[model samples]
Target: MNRRRFFGFLQKEFRHIFRDRRTMLILFGMPIVQILLFGFAITNEIKNVNVAVLDMAHDDVSRDITNRILSSEYFHLYQNLHSEKEIEAAFKSGKVKEVIVFENNLAKNIYSKNIGNIQLIGDATDPNTANTIVAYTRAILLNYQQELNKGSKPPAIIQTEVRMWFNEELKGVYLFVPGVMTIIMMLVSAMMTSISLAREKETGTLEALMVSPLKSWQVILGKVIPYLVLSFSITLLTLGLSMFVFHVPIRGNIFLLLGEVLLFVITALSFGILISSIAPNQMAAMLISMMGLMLPTIILSGYIFPIDNMPVPLQVISNIIPARWFISMLRDIMLKGAGWSVVWKDTCVLAFMAVVFLFLASRRFKMKLR
Candidate 1:
C-alpha cells in the first residue's frame, strides 16, 4: 500500500510538470535554442569579409594577387577604387573591412627590380578580427612571393605595408566598452521594467490602475519614466568609467552620443513593456527577458562575436535585435568619431522599433483593461 501511494504521487508530479507549458518550454525549448545559438554564434573564425582594392598597377601581378585573396573563403571583393582618396570614405561607410593597394608597376618591379610594394589597410574597430584578417592576407601574399621566387637566384621580396585604421594600437577596450554599455543599458531598462510591470500584474495593482481614471498610455508612461531615467544615468556612468578608467575615447559629439543613448533606452523600455504585457507573472517576465533579450543581446548583437562571421540565419535574426544597432552606433561615435551622418540609419531603425513595441504594448494593455 505504501509503495503504491509513492508511485501515485510520482505520477501526479509528472503529470503536473507535463501540463505546464511554461515549464516544458523552460525545460525543452530554452536548452535547444541556447545550444543552437551558442554552437553557431560563438566562433572566432571569420568568413566572407568584405575588402576593397585600389590597384594603381592594374598589371597581371596585381590582378593575380587580387584574385588570390578573393578566391579564398575568407574574403569577398566589395569594391574597386581608382584613387587613394577613396580609402577613407570606404572605411567610413562601414561596408569595407580591408583595402588592398598595389603600387604602379607591380609586375614590372617584381621582375626587373626583384621587389614589389603592396599596402594592406584594415579596419581595426574590432581588433581581433582585424588582426586575423591582416594575418591571412600576409600569408596569401607570402605564398605568392614564394611561388615567384622558386626559379630565381635572389628571391623577389613583396614589401607589404600594413595599416590598421581607427584603432591603430588595436585596443580591446575600444571594442568591449560599447558592447558592455549596451548590455548594461538593456538589462537595467528592459529586464527591470518588464519584471516591475509583471510584478504589478501579479500583485493585482495593474488591474486596479486599469479600473481607475488613469489612461492606458499614462499608466504605461508612469511605469516607464523612472526606469528610463535610471537607464540613462547608468549609461552616463558607464561612459565615464570607460573614458576615465579604461581610457576609451569618445571622439564624436558628446551631445549626439547622449541623444543616441536616450533613443536606445526608450527602445529598450518599450521592449520591456511589450514583454511584460505578454508575460503571465514576474518570473515569466524575468525568464523572457533573460532568454529573449539578454542572451540575444550578448550573442547576436555583434558584441562579443562578429556578426559577419555568424551563419546567414543568425545574421538575419540579429537585425531585429535592438542592441545590434545601438552597439554599432556606440562604436562609430566613440571609437571612430562618427557623426550623425554615419549613425542616422541605425538611429532611425531603433526609433521605428520603439514605436512598434509601444504600439503593441498599448494594445495589449487595453485588452487587459477590457
Candidate 2:
C-alpha cells in the first residue's frame, strides 16, 4: 500500500509540473533558446567584414591585390575611395572597418625596384577585431608576394604599414568598458525596477495605490524616478572609473555622452515597467528580466562577439536589443570621439523604442487597473 501511495504521489507531481506554463518554459524553453544562441551567436571567426580600398596606383597590380582581399571570405568590398580625405569619413560612418591604400605607381615600384608599399588603416574601437583584420590583410599580401617569386631571380617584396585608429595600443579595456557599462545599466535599471513594481503587486500594495487618488502614470513615475536617479548615479560612477582608472578617453562632447546615457536609462526603465505590467509576481518579473533583457544585452549586443560574425538570423534579432545601439553610441562617443552627426541615427532609434515601450506599458497598466 505504501508503494502504491508513493507511485500516486510521483504521478501527481509530474502532472503539476506539466500544468505550470512558467515551469515548463523554465525547464524546456530556456535551455533550447540558450543552446541555440550559444551555438550560433558565440563565434570568434569573422566573415563579410566591410572594407574600402583606396587604389591610388589604379594599375594592374593594385587592382589584383584589391580583388584578392575582397574575394576572400573574410572581407567584402564596401567602396572605392577617391582620396585619403574620404578615408576618415568612411571610418567615421562606421560602415567600413578597414581601408587598404595602394601607394601610387605600385606596379612600377614592384617591377622596377622589386618593392611595393601598401598601407592598412583599421578602425580599432574593437581592438580584437582590428588585430584580426590586420593579420588577415598582411597574410594576403604575403601570399601575393610569394606568388610573384616562383622561379624568379629576385623575390618582389611588399612593404605593409599598419595603422590602428582610435586605439593605438589595442587596449582590450576600451571594448570592455562600454560593454560592461551597458550590461550594468540594463540590469540595475530594468531588472530592479521590474522586480520592485512586481513586489508591490504581489504584496497587494499596488492595488492599494490604484484605489487611491493617484493616476497610473503618476504611480509609474513615482516608481521610475528613484531607479532613474540610481541608474544615472551608476553611469557617472562607471564613467569616472573608466576615465581615471582605465585611462579611456572621452574625446567627444561630455554633454552629449551624458544625454545619451540619460536617454538609455529612461528606455531601460520603461522596458522594466513593461515587463512588470505583464508579469504576475516578483519572481516572474525577475526571471523575465534576466531571460529577456540580460541575455540579449550580453550576447546579441556585440559586447564580446562581433555582430558581423554572427549568423544572419541572429544579426537580425540583435536590432531589437536596445543595448546594441547604446553600446555602439558609447563606443563612438567615448572611444572614437564621435560627434552628434555620427550618433544621431542611433539616438533616434533609442528614442523611438522608449516611446513604444512606455505606450504599451501604460495600456497594460490601465487594463489591469480596469
Candidate 3:
C-alpha cells in the first residue's frame, strides 16, 4: 500500500464526514438521545402504576391490604369500587392498569383456616407490565402473610426467593445499556458506512476512484477507516454515559471490552460494505441497513426478548444475527464479570463472521467495478 495515497484518501473521507452536519448529528446526537431515552424513559420496572380496589369486605384486613399496596412504590390506589362491574370501565378508560378484588369474608376465611380469595385483575395488553404488577402484588400479600404468622408456625410453604444475579435491583438501565450500545454501533459502523460508500457510487466518485492508482482494497479501507474511528468514539461516549450517568458497571477487564468492541465494529462494517456493494444508491443502502440490520439487531439479537422464548425457527434465525453474539458477550463481561474463557466462543463467532462478510463484500465490490 502507498502510504501517501492511503493517508490522502483517509483525509478526504474524514473531511466528507465533518463537512456534513447531518452526519455529525447522527454520529454524536443519536447515541446520547437513545441511551438516555432507554435508560430512563423505557423501563420494565413498575413504578407509580394506577390500580382500582374492589373491597366487598370493608374489614380491617382488607383495608390494611389496600393500604399496604398503595403505600408501596409499585401501585397507586386510583379509586375504590363496591362491585366488580366497575373493573371493565376502569380498564376500558385506561385509567387503571390493575384491579384488586377482596372476597366478602376475607378476614373470617383467613382466621378460620379457610382459603381467603383475592383476585388480581390486570390489563393484559402489556403482558410484561401485567406480570410484573401481579408479581409485586403477590409479594406484598406474602409480606402481609408473614406479618400475620410472625409467631405461629405456618404449614409447609414452598417459598421460592428469586435472586437476580449480576443485577440485583433489576434496573432497566442494566438491561438496556448493552442493547443500546449494539444498536448504536451497528447504525454508526454498518449503516453509516454503507450509505457513505453508496453516496460515492451515486455521485460518480466511485468510478474515478476505481480508475485511480489506489487498489480496490485501499479504496474500501479508506471509506471504512473514517467510520471505524467515529464508531469507536461513539462506543467510548456510550460506555462513559452508561457508567457515569446510568451507573452500569463494567466489571470485566477494560482491554477485553475494547477488544470485543473492535471485533464487533469490524464485523458490522463488513456487513455495511456487503450492503453497499449490492445497493445501487444511498437510499437503498440506508433502507437495507435500517430494515435488514436494525430490525434483526433489535428483535432477534435477544436484546429486548429472550431467544429461547421464541419459536424454534426464530431461535435458529437469531444465531445468524451478529448482534446476538456481541450483546451476549457484553452482558457476560459487564454484568457477570466473565473472562475470556467464558466469552471466547462468542469472539470466535464474530471474527469468523467478519471474515466471511468481508470476503463476500470484497468479491461483490470488485464485481461491481467490472
Candidate 4:
C-alpha cells in the first residue's frame, strides 16, 4: 500500500541482484549460452548416412538408382553386398543404416508392369533415422521413374501431393526454441527464486523482514518481482536468438506469445516460492528445484521426445508437468499460427497451474513466516 516503501524495497532487491556477480551472470549469460548450445548441438537432419546396396539386376537402371542413392548428400554408399546373407552383417556392424535391394528384374518389370519393387531393409534400432532413410530413397526412386517416363510413352502418371505443415523446412531449431525457453524460465523463475529466498532464511534477513512492517505476501513479492523482470528479459533474449540467430519464425501474435510466457513465469515463480518456504537452506533449495523441477521439465515436457510415443504411465505423468502445456502452447503459437481458439485449452491449463501454485505457495509462506 505504501508506494515509497515499495519503491525502496524494489531498489533494495535490484541492489541485491546487481551486487552478486554470479546472479548477474545467471540472469544474463546463461540464457544466451543455453540457447546457442541447444540450437546447434541437437538436430534432426540426417546426412552422410551409410547405406549398403544389393543390386541383383546389375543392369543400367539398377546401377543408375544405386548411383543416385550413393551420390545423394543424405547418404553414402558404404559397401556393395553380394547376397542376402551380407545384408545382416552390414546392419549388424552398425555401419549401414539401410540396404537397398534391387529385385531380380528391375528394368524388365518397369518396362512391362510400369512398376519395380525395390526392397528397403532398414536398421529398426534407430526408427527415426531408418524412416528418413526410406523416405529419401523413395524420393530418389520416384525421380528416376519420372525421368524414365518422360523418355517413354506412359499411359498414366500418378502424382502424389505432399504437404508439410508447421515446419515446412523441418529445422530442428524450431522445436528447440520453445523447449529451451521452458527449461530456462523454470530455472530462472523457480530455481533462482527458491535459492534466493532460502539464502535470506539462512542469513536471518527473512526474520528481520518478518519483524518489519512488510506483510508476508509483500516479502515474497519483493523477492520474486526482481526475478520476474529478469525472467522476462531472458525470454526476450531467447526470442531474439531464436528469430535472428536461428531464423525460427513466430507465426502467431507476439503479444499473445508474451502473455503466455508471463503466465508461465508466474507459475514457475510461485512453485519456487513454495520450495523456498520449506527448504532448510539454499543448497537444499537448489537441489530440490533441479531434481524435482528441471529433470521433470526436460524429460516429461515433450521437449526433446514426442509425448505420443511415451509409455502410458509416462504419458500420464507428463500431464502433470506444467512445461507440457507451455511447450504445446508455444508450438501452437509459433509453428501453427494458432489463435486463442486453437490454444485456449493449453492457456487455460497454464492459468490453472498459476492459480494453484500461487495458492499453495501463499499458504506455505504464511505458515513458515508465522
Candidate 5:
C-alpha cells in the first residue's frame, strides 16, 4: 500500500462529507427518530382495555359483582349487557376486548355453601397482553370473593402477595422511560457520529483533515465532543419527562445514574467510530448502525422481553449488547433506587467495552486513513 496516497485520499473524503447539506440534515434527524420510536412505538405494559360485562344473574349480588369489575383501573366497562347475546354482539363488533359474566345463582349458591363460576372471555389476538388482563380481572373478582369468605375460614389458603420490587406502582413508563431513552440516545449518538465520520471518507475531505498536522485522536475528538453534549442533554430531557410527567421515581443516587449514562454514551460513540473505520459512506454507516445497534437494542436487550426467560442462546447473545447493561443499570437506579454498590460491576463492564472499542477504532482509523 502507498501510505502517502492512502492518507491523501482519506483527507479529501472527510472534507467532502462535512460540506454536504444532506449529510448535515441526516446527522440531526437520527436523534429525533430514535427518541420518537422509543417513546411511542416500543412498550411492555398493557392498559385501558375495553370490556363488556354481562349479568345473567340479574340479582343484587350480580349487580354488586358487576360494579366490582367496572371499578378496576385496568378495565373500562364501556358496555353493560343484559344477556350473553349482547356480549356476543360486543365481541363481534370488536368494541370490547374482554367479556365478564357472573353465574345466574351467584348469591344463592354462596349462601348454600356451593362454588359458583365467574367466567372471563378474553380476545386472544394479542395473547400475551390479553392473558395479563385476564389475570388482573380474576384478581379483582377473587379479592371480592375473599371479602365474602372472611366470616368463614378455609382449610388451606393459597395467598399470593405480589411485591413489585423497585417500582411500587409498576408504571410502564417507570422502567421503560429510562431504558428506552438510553437506547434512543445510544442509537442516535453512535449512528450520527459514525455516519458523520464515514461521510468524510465518502466525500473525499478526510485528506484535508489528515494532511493538517492534526493528530488522529484530535480529529476523532472534534467529531465526538459535540455529540457528547447533545446526547447527554437528550438524556436529561428524557429523565425529566419521566420524573415530572410520567412520575417515574429515582430510588438511587443521581450521580451514579449520570456516571452510567456517560459510560454508555462513550461506549456507543466508540462503537460508531469503529464502524466508521471500515464503512465507505453514509449509507453504509446508516445500515450498519441500524442492523448492528438499533435492532439488537430493541429485541435482545431485554427492553421488550424478560431476559431470564429467553432461550439460553439468546441470553448469551444479549450479553454483548451495550444497552443490556444500561437497561439494567437504569432500571436499578430509577426503579429500585440502586447505587454504585449495586451497579459497579455493570459500570466496569461498560467501561471496559468503551476502552476496548476506542483502542480498536483508533488503530483501525489511523491505519485506514494512512
Candidate 6:
C-alpha cells in the first residue's frame, strides 16, 4: 500500500532482470550468434560435396556425365578409380562423401537399350545431407537422360532436372542460419522472458507490483519493453550478419521484413507474459517454455524437417506453432522474393496468434492481480 516502497521495488526488480549476465546473453547475444551459426549448419540441400568416380567403362558417355557433375559444382572428384576395388577404398578412406560408379557396359547400354544404370554410393554419417546428395546424383543422371531422350524422343521418359532456387548452392549451413535464428529468438523471447518474470513471483516481488499504483500495464510494459528491444536488436543483428558475412540475401521488402519481425517479437513476448501468468516459479516456466513451445517451434517450424512431409497429425500440430508461419513467411520473403501479396496468408496467421497470446496473457495477468 506504500507508494514509495512499491515504485522503488519495481525499479530494483527491473535492474535485476537487466543485470543478469545469463539472461542478457540469452536475450541479446544468442539470437545473433546462434542464428548465424545455425545458418551455416542447417541446410537440406548439397553442393560442392566431395565425390569419387569409379569409371570402369571409361566410355565417352560416362565421361560426359562426370564432366556435367563436376561442372555443376555439386561435385568435386577426388579420385578417378580404374577398378571396383578402388571404390571400396575411396569410400572407406573418407576422402569422398559420395562415389559414382559407371558399369563397364555404360556406353553400350546407352547406345542400344537407351538406358544406363549409375550406382551412387553416399556417406550415411550425415544421413540428411547424404540423402540430398544421392538425390542430386540422381538428378545429374536424369539430366543426362533428358539430354539423350531429346534426340531419340522416347515415350514415357522419366527425366528430372532438379533446380534448387533461392539457395542455388543448396548448402545446409545457409538454410540453418535463418532457422537457428528463428528458433533461438522464439526460445529467448518467450521462455526466457517468462522465466525471468516468473522469478519475481517466486520471490514475492510480483505481488508487490500488482499492489502498486504504477498500473498493471506499466509494470508489464516495463518488464517486457526492454527485453523486446534487446531481442529485436538481436534479430536485426542476425539478419545483417547473415546478409553480409554469410552472403545471404534479403530479397523481399525491407519494411515487410521489419514488420514480420515485430509481429514475431510481440508474439514471443506475449507468450512469455502468458507463461509468467500460469507458472508459479522460474523452473516451471522454463520447462513449460522449452518443452511446450521451443521444441515444437523447432520440430514443427519446418526448420529441421519439412512440415509438408510430416505425418498428418504432426502436420496438424504444426498449425499451432507460430514458428511454422514465421518460417514460411521468412522463406517466401527471404528465398522466393515473395511480396506481401504472396506471404499475406502467413502474415495474417501470425497476427492472429499475436492477438490470441496477448489476449490470454492480459486476461491471466488481470485475474492474478485480483
Best by lDDT: 3
Q: Which ten residues in a row have the lowest lDDT in candidate 1?
A: 30-39
Off by over 4 Å in 4: 23-34, 151-171, 311-313
Q: Tens-digit lDDT track for model 6 on 247-294?
A: 777788978988898899889899999998898899999999989898
**Which residue pairs show backbone clashes in model 2?**
none
Supply the TM-score for candidate 5. Answer: 0.76
Candidate 6 backbone collisions, by pair: 38-176, 38-177, 39-173, 39-176, 39-177, 40-173, 43-172
- State the C-alpha lDDT per candidate: 0.81, 0.81, 0.86, 0.84, 0.74, 0.77
Q: Residue-wise lDDT of candidate 2 within 1-370, one digit each (tens)? A: 6445444434543454347667445433433343333333433347899999999998999999988988999999999999999999999999999999999999999999999999999888866688878878998999999998898788889999999633233455666667777877787679978987898899987787676555677667767776676567767766776677556689999999999999999899999999999898999999999999999899999997879889999999999999999999999998899999999999999999999998888888752454
CA deviation > 4 Å runs, candidate 3? 45-47, 108-117, 152-171, 366-368
The Cα error of candidate 6 at residue 34, in Å, is 2.7
Ranking by lDDT: 3, 4, 2, 1, 6, 5
307: Cα error in model 4, Å: 2.9
lDDT at 187 for candidate 5? 63
Tens-digit lDDT track for model 1 on 1-370? Answer: 6445444434543454347667445433433343333333533347899999999998999999999999999999999999999999999999998999999999999999999999999888866677768878999999999998998998899999988543243445567767877887888778877887888789987787666655667667766776676667666766776577556789999999999998999889888989998898999999999999999999999998889889999999999999999999998999889999999999999999989987887778762543
TM-scores for all predictions: 0.57, 0.57, 0.84, 0.86, 0.76, 0.76
Off by over 4 Å in 2: 1-170, 367-370
RMSD, model 3, all Cα superposed?
4.2
| Tens digit of per-residue lDDT, candidate 3, span 1-370 | 5899999999999999999988799779988998899777775668999999999978888899899999998899888887778889999989798888888878877777635778888777876567667778878988888787777564312132322212233456787788988998999899989999999999998888777788889888998999999999989999999899988899999899999999999999999999999899999999999899999999999998988889999999999999999999999999889999999999999999999999998888872464
Task: Please give the lDDT score at residue 102 for candidate 1.
Answer: 99
TM-score between model 6 and native: 0.76
Per-residue lDDT, model 5, residue 152, is: 68
lDDT of 1 at 247: 64
lDDT of 4 by residue, 224-301 (tens): 899999899989999998899888889999999999999999999999999998898999999999999999999999
Task: Please rank every candidate by TM-score, starting with the best.
Answer: 4, 3, 6, 5, 2, 1
Supply every candidate's count of residue pairs whose N, Cα or C atoms clash at under 3 angstroms: 0, 0, 0, 0, 20, 7
